[model samples]
Target: MPKMVFIETDGTRREVDAPLGLSILEVARRHDIDLEGACEGSLACSTCHVVVAPEWYDLLPDAQEDEEDMLDLAFGLTKTSRLGCQIRITPELDGLTVKLPGAK
Candidate 1:
């Protein structure tokens, strides 16, 4: 089984099982992480924004224009920021790590 880590704003690290094919937002939600997918993974909101660890960022597929646009509205966006709904879990991303953005 694949696994990933989510770092909270308060520096807590949560490692959880990451089912293949599910979006990061889905995984977060399942584990009771605080990511708010306000758009229900419809790519209509930036509430699920997350910062990918630099080492894992390039492993992810490039975000689509719509996701990029939504990310622009994310609080505390960073060079590795990505919309959680835009990133799907895959074998290649087994050890993925992302940080929750600071609250707005």
Candidate 2:
């Protein structure tokens, strides 16, 4: 199993196991973290927006155009901003870190 660290808006960090292939959003929701995937994993919304750690951001696959369009609506977009739903936990991301943007 892979693992990941989540940095909350208040600066708290929590680490959790991420089953291979599960999206960051799933791990957050499973652990009761504050992220809100309002559209489930449908990619229809940007409610699961997260800022990937700079070092880890490059390891993720490029975002699709649709996800990019939705990211445009994210509350605090950044160079590493991504839809948590679109990032799967692969072996390369065993210790991934991402920060949850402050609440809208």
TM-score of each: 0.96, 0.96
Once superposed on the true structure, which residue ranges of model 2 sit more than 4 Å away at CA? none
lDDT of 1 by residue, 1-104 (tens): 89999998889998999999999999999999999999999988899999999999999999989999999998898999999998999999999999999722
Q: Per-residue alpha-carbon lDDT of model 2 for 1-104, expressed as tens digits?
A: 88899999888988999999889999998899999999998989999999999999999999999999999999989999999999999999999999999722
lDDT of each: 0.93, 0.93
Error of 1 at 23 (Å): 0.5
Q: How much does candidate 2 score in TM-score?
A: 0.96
Worst 10 contiguous positions by lDDT, candidate 1: 95-104
The true-versus-predicted C-alpha distance at residue 91 of model 2, in Å, is 0.4
